[model samples]
Structures are given as structure tokens and as C-alpha cells.
Target chain A: MDFKKITIFAGHYGSGKTNLAVNLAFHHKAQGRDCTICDLDIVNPYFRSKDSEEDFKAAGIRFISSPFANSNVDLPSIPAEAYSVFAKSDTYSVIDLGGDDRGSYALGRFSEFLTDESTYDMLMVINQYRPDTRTPEQVLEIKKEIEDACHVKFTGIVNNSNLGRETTVELIERTREFADECAKLLNLPLVMTTYSDKLEKPNMPNPFAINIMAKDIWQV
Target chain B: MAEKVLMKGNEALAEAAMRAGCRFFFGYPITPQTEVAAYMAKHMRKNGGTYLQAESEIAAINMVLGAASAGQRVLTSSSSPGISLKSEGISYLAGSDLPAVIINIQRGGPGLGGIQPSQSDYFQATRGLGHGDFHVIVVAPSTVQEMVNLTYDAFDMADLYRMPVMILGDGILGQMMEPAEFPTESSRKLPAKDWATTGTKGERKKNIVNSLYLDPAELERTNFERYERYEKIKATEQKAECFMTEDADIVVVAYGAAARVAKNAVLAARDAGIKVGIVRPITLWPYPSDTLKEVAKTAKAFLSVELSMGQMVEDIKLSIDCAKPVYLCNRTGGMVMKPDEVLAKIKEISGGLK
Candidate 1:
């Protein structure tokens, strides 16, 4: 799961991309690469990269947490620590963007610094089951909106499709064609299909599995 | 005409309002409901309509009152906390018998509770809003199609009774996208603004749109007249929808997004050979009480589901007004209840009767 020097994850909220990014961060760190993960979400602080600071620290992964002492404030504060990704060219960094266009637009401020820099991948995560992206057309519209907001092109697409805890192997299998339709619309490569299962199983379409960790502990 | 276009509920409802002859809008921006004002800002000016974002919710609602007093169709929208601030002005509109539409795309709240979707404001909406004996006509919509339908008709109904009308939605309904079709402009019907405060020009007689009455007896007489209008509205304007309710012994009652979840649970329960149905309240204030009371006569029990701390359950009991075991299945503080959990409650309640 070790990616390019800079890997940015973008998707709507509850698309399960945050958990997938967390898994990829630890995977890169375990592969003996210097890794950093930063929370680029100024819209919603819940279920973002900042909430997993302790776990990232345990794995020797540097985390750029939200600057606000109160996470709920609508302050547009992008941490200065996040710019280390642009400076340190060798660091395998993953950025968890805000859940929507409003959150994703923060990347536009750093567009000058992110110009074709030393190997980067910005993948738009698509979950077919999410209410906002029920169709391939909708997914394409969201991708265009994010591109318009961030002024950065999406390099690839990731099919992190699942129905929360009710996800099944067959459900994931059903999502493959939907993901393909979206990928074909954007002419982008399908990166990987992620599953919450940690097992190595054959006969499945793809095997990018994650031991899910980040969750809202405050949720009732 | 364009067949159907994908739009968020907030935007769709705003478009519908404009098509319904509402040429004036005043609202403050708030979470999960800002799309309405954003859309209005982009298009209201081009359409020869007036769109103003007030300094606050208080200022917005009063602007609505002012524009409506001039006999112009006007609208305003906000979320839970913002709606609370507008309640004082809404009460004033009710007292003055002015017609206006106020959309509350609800969010979790008691005091700036959270930005997530919730249904806890049923009490404040259906019961008297402020310090007055008045009721705003509350309409609850479960889908984007209904959001368009209800918002298009809210203005007409408000004018029909010369009272305040509310489109009580939640964050999910406001932010979620779906296909909606707008009514043809020619098909729209609006009463003439003859009662307008446009310069009297010494035509015949001046019109006063004030809500104040100095004498105690006069105030009491004005209230009686208002109650007479409310009674007429209640008799003719109750709306509801029933799903799989023909032969079901257990009924699940809910509205808005909570109704969406309950509909899924009822479908799953029906497939498992359990007789269950869902009764969705479309008009929540003049709530579908008569229909619910009739359905209660045949059902074994009633389960009123909500995304709040069990506020609508009180109305459910009042509608039936019986000992027929009207129970509650609820979640609060921005938590959405899952289908399996609600299904389990259905089984548990039905099991007790056996």
C-alpha cells in the first residue's frame, strides 16, 4: 500500500476514505518509509486524520493535527506543519481532505507549492452506496466540483465502496461495475478496492484490506 | 419542459418557492440549509426578485414580515437554532394574519447542539411557537420530490389561511441530492396582491396589517377569529401517506428522514412475514391525526419513531388518545437510528401482544 511521495484522499463524508487513508499510512510506515499524515479538514473535525494522532505516533508516523483547541469552531486555520510534505520530498505523506468541496477547497491555497512536485497522487475516492454519489454521473460531477475547488487534477480513483458494518463480499463485488463506470467517465485509472477484512483471500477482485481503526468515540 | 434535473433539496425547495410566485426572500446562512440562500442569491436578482441575507435570523424573519405586509409573497429559511431566533417574528406573523413561508431545515439542537441532522424540534413547531396561542402550519417532507411539492404548496396554503407555514425538514433532506421537476410557470396560481401596502394613492380606504389590539375585549375577539381560521384549516388541510398498511397489525409512525429509515424497516419486516406498515405524517402540525386514530382502531400497536428525544411520541398518543399501546423508538443528539434496531423494536412490541 506504499504510494507516491504525496498521496491525497478526497471524498464525501462517510465514504470510508478516512479509514482507508489511516490503513495506508501505517502500511507505508511499516515498509520502512518516512511517513506523515495531515488533516486538511477545516469543515468537520470529526472522523478526520487529526483524531488518530496517538496511533500514528505509535507507528512512528508524524501527524499534522488540527490547530484549533476546540475542533468544532469554523476557523479556517490550515496548520503550518502540513507544509512539511512539500519541503521534505522523500516523505510518504497522505492528506485527508475535508469531506466535501468546502473542505477540499483548502488545497487551493497551497496550489503554488504543489506544482508537479516530486511524485504525487491525488485520488478521488468513490463509494457507490453513498447517497450523494448514487450514480456514475453524480460521481463525475463531484469529481469536477472538487477539481474546481482545489485547482488540482485527480490522478486516479479508488473504489472504497461499502455499506458500513453491513458490508459483504458480494456487496463489494456488486460495486465493481459501478466503480468502473465512474472511472471510465473520468478516464482515470482505478487504483485499488479496499475492504475492512484483514484476511488474504483469493478469488476476490482485489486485495487491499485494512484493519479499521479510526472511529468517532463520541458517537452515541 | 426539462424533464427532471438533479438538485439538492435546499436548492430545489428554493426554486419551487420562486416558481410559486414568491418574489422576495430574506434569510441568514446556517449549516446544512445555506444552499437555499446561496441559490436565491444567484438567481433571485435575475428573476426580478429581491434576495437579502440579513445580519441575523432575527433580522431575516422581520424582513419576511415586512415584505409580506406589503402583500408580496416572501420566504425565509434556517436551521434549528436559527429557527428558534425567528420564532418571535413567526409568532408576530401569525398574530397579524400575514401569509409567508419559513423553511426550517432542522439540525440537532437545544442550544447549538450539533450540525448533524435531527428531528427534535417537533414540539416547538407543532405546539405554540412563542408566547402566543398560534400554530404555524407545519409540513414535513421525506424525499426531494416531496420537498419540492410541499414548498411549492406551502405559500399557497399560507395565503389560503393568511397564516405562517413551515417546511420542517432536516439536514439530510436539505443536503441530499435527488431528481426534481418544477411546475410550469403558467400552471401556477397566486392570489392578487390587492391588499398590498403599495401607495394607497387615496383610492378608497387604507388597510392596516397590525397585530396589536389595545382593549382586552378586542384582543380576546381577535383571538377568537384567529382560532376560527385554525379550526377551518385543521378540518380541510391534514395530509398523510400510508405504506403497506392495508392488513398490517402493527403500525410504525414517523416523518421526514426518520420516516425514510422507518420505511426501510417496515419493508424488511414485511418480507420476514411480520405484518408491519408505516404511516408518514406529511403535514405535521394539522398532523394526520384523524387517519392515525382510524388506523389505530385496527392495528395491534403503534410505534412512533423519531430522530429526537421522543417529542413526536406525545403527539402520537394525543392523536389516538387511547390505551392502545402507542410506544416509542427514538435516537437523539444527531444519531440516526439504523433499520435493524427499529425492526427489532417492532418484533419486541408485537411479541408482547402475543
Candidate 2:
């Protein structure tokens, strides 16, 4: 069996970064491989790893979260357990950073621990429908801003454009094409595309990995 | 029996419902509880079950009532405002004695409250939700694992008593994740369906399930019988978890997510050379009054920490016969009291210098 490498995800809010991270974690876990997720999203309180912690835990996956990560403006510093996991984990680890330029800046603090080739794959999630970066030029600009803040090169792109549960395959495929174009211009790989399962089937043909919504345990 | 897995409350409830043979679900999306819907939507379909995303919470709960009446094990969920919409249906279901499960991942209330977790629904859940005089079995889960475990118990208790069972949770419990084991499919049993409102065959007369009993005497008898069941539930099913109350100077009382915060505060207080303990009520409707009364005999004061202004404090005071000073420490409107806030209150109430 091949070892699952640690994948680091970062992007602005509504960029679909978490969607990519959660789906990748699920995909690997579903294949009977151990996957661990660290929810580092301390910015957006609503749509973060804290909301979906139980779902990942139910899949026999390990999860670590910051205490009072949400609601408390005084963001507690990252716990020591996160560093231990990052340093020693043999299984696939997915670090879901927050959704802001500050999120990128936050990653710079961990640079001392990260090696040049510690299997780091930084994926910048983009959504064409969102206001911050509707056009390709704007997406590129946001990408540069992230890279500058984190001092890390982004290796891939994930297009996660959708209108809530009403998304369709045509929209996903269109976003996929946009991501492909961005990847070509930036010299980065088109890593993945995500769509809500309510809108489209999971079997889309693409060179990149696909991300679909998994079951949430606390829906009611 | 399945091995115990360290699980959060929301995930546990979802897995436990499946283990109890619940297959049909209808619900709308809400915060602190979206996980339960998400879980049921994915796993229910995989298990040859039905999961539907209703347009509104009202439609979702009514759909649950329909499914339950058709002799199917079903459930629906929501938070505070959504639960307010569900109350009409819940009262009807309770009056008709239809067994079903309703989860309230409680948040701040009265209107479209912020999505931060709060337990302000204590009064709404416990003191007869709708117009008629009726009681639903309310279970308070303090841990993620209990959320799963008690859900199974909720379904069984609902069926056995022919009543609606509610798992009252907060956003903290619903959203937080911990390690949990998935129960094997073989451990579940399909509940007997003799009382369901499925179409009656030739051998039996048509069955009617309704809360409207026109005759006053008959309705009164039904009410009395329901009270009898509630009495039995109160007598036999009062659940509480006490930590280090023996020979403690101060006892802190809390439930659900608040209980967890209090537990941490108590630990911190102990570390600081304060003899503070905690009493957590697992069954909210039964209220664990007897236990509180018993603990009041030795403890100097009872500090009530809640997400509301002072709802559960009244119950604590009443239960303990005012033998001890029942103090209130709370934060409302989707705000969860921090451990520091609770500890400060404990110290202040115990006459310690701040």
C-alpha cells in the first residue's frame, strides 16, 4: 500500500478550500486508508472543521481542533498536539487552514517545522461565482497574495463553484476548465474539483480528483 | 455488543439511530445540527433507507409524522426556531402516542438567534411545548458518545411508551467531533409495529391516530394515563452524573454543554485548592431532582450555570428545598459561558476573593 502524504490546503473565505480538504480526507478514508484532519480554520466560525468534526470521527478518521476556536475572539494558540501530529504522522494528514489572507500569514509561523520537501502540497481553492475573484485575473491576484503571505508556492488548484444545493454538473465542469486555465498559467497542477452531491453525480471525467459532499451527522 | 468509541454527541446520535433500525428521515438544514442531517442523508441511502431534504422545517417534521404513521421508524431535527415550528407537530404526535425521535440542537432563541450554541430551550422543551397539556421524553446528552448511545435508548423508550423522545442538545454538542465506533448492523432490531397507523387488514378494524379526542371524559382519561406514564418515567428514569460531590464545599449544577464547561471549571477549582464539584442532569424532563435534593444535604451552596438567564436555577432551588443558596451564572443569545467565567462565578458564590 502506498503511503498517504500530508496535503496542506489554504485559500480565502468562500474559496472552497475546506470543501476540497474534507472531500480529499473522505476519499482517502473511504479507500480503507487512515486519514487525519486538523481543522485550522479559526476565522470563519460557521463553515469550518468544527462543524464537521463528528462526520470525520465516525469514519474512523482522527481529527484535532483548537479549543474555543470559534466564538472566542481571543483565538487560543495552536495546541502542541497539532505539531506532534504534523511531525510524526505516517498516515495521510490534511491541514485545513482558515479562509483569509491572515490564514496564509498564519502558515508562516509553522515554516520552521516544515522542510523543503516534507511532502507539502499547497492547493489554492477558487470559486468563480464568489465576489473576491470572479475573473481569472482576480483569481491569479488572490493566489499571488496568498503565496506572498505564506512564503510557500501553491502546487495545485481546486475549482469549487456552486450555488448551494442547486449546483449542476455543467457549472462544475465549467469551473474545472477555469481551474485548468489558471493551473496552466501559474505552472501548478489542477488538483481537484468539488460539487455538492445534491446537484450532480460523482462520476465526472477529469484529470484532477473530484470532491462530492459526504454525509453530515448533525443535520437535524 | 460493540466496543465503545470516544465519540461526540451529534455523531453518536446519528449512528445510534441507525443501530435502532431508524431508516426514514426528513429535515431542513440548521446550524449546530447540520451534521445529523448530513450523516443521515449519506448513510441512510447507503443502508437502503430514505433521506429527504424538506423545503422547510415545518414540512420536514410533518413528513416525519407521515412516515411514523405508516409504520416506519423515522425522525426529524432542528435547533431553537426550527424546533418552535416543530412544536405543533410534536404535540400532535405526542397526543396520538406515535413513537418518534426529535433532536433540538439548541441555540439562542425567541427569533433568528445567532448560531453559537446555547441551551435556552430548557423551558420550551420541558414545560409542554404546544397548546395542549402533553410531555415528551427529553434526554440531555453531555458527551458526544452519549448523544449516540441515548438516541438508541430514546427510540426504544419512545416505542415502549408510545411517546415522542427528544434529544435536547446544543451547538457545542452538535458541532464538536470526537472518536466514535460505528455499531454493527446485526446489533439492531426492528421494533414491533402493532400500534402503527398502517392500513388495517381484513382481520382488524381501521386504526385512527389523532390527538383530538372530542369527549372531555375520554380525553381526561387519556391525559391521566399519560400522566401515569410520565410519573413512571420520572420515578424510574431520572439520570444524573455527579462528580466529587462527596465532602465538597460547593456543588455546581449544569447540563448539556454547560455541564462540560462546569466540569472543567470544577477541575480547575480543585487544582486551586477549592472543593467544588459538579452535578449534571442527563435526563432533563425527569430533572434528577431527587439527586439534587440528596446532594443539597451536604454541599454548602449550589451554583447553576446555564446558557440562559436563570431557567434551570429555579428547578435546582425548588428541588433542593432552598436548603442551599442556588446561584445563577449564565450567558444568553448563543453565547456559551467560558470555563473562566464559570470558575469566577463559583469562586464568588463560595465567598472567595476574586
The top-ranked prediction according to DockQ is 1
Best by lDDT: 1
Q: Following a full C-alpha superposition, what root-mean-square deviation does model 2 have from the true structure?
A: 14.9
List candidate 2 segments past 4 Å from native: A1-220, B1-9, B183-191, B352-354
Candidate 1 C-alpha lDDT tens digits along A1-220: 3378888888765566667778888989878988888777766523456667778878899888667723435466888887787785677888888766777888888777677834788888877765467788988888888888998888888887765555667767877788888889989888888887643342334458777675422112
Query: Model 1 clash pairs?
Result: none
Candidate 1 interface RMSD after superposing interface residues? 8.6
DockQ, candidate no. 1: 0.09
Give the per-residue lDDT of model 1 (tens digit) for B1-354: 444555668888888898888899999988768879977986799789999999999999999999999988899999999999999999899988899999998888789987777898899899957778888899999888789888878988888778999999988788665666676653345577666577788885777888788898998999999898888888988999999887889999999988888888898888888899989999998988888988887888899999888788888888989647788998877777888888899989878978
In model 2 chain A, the worst 10-residue window by lDDT is A211-220
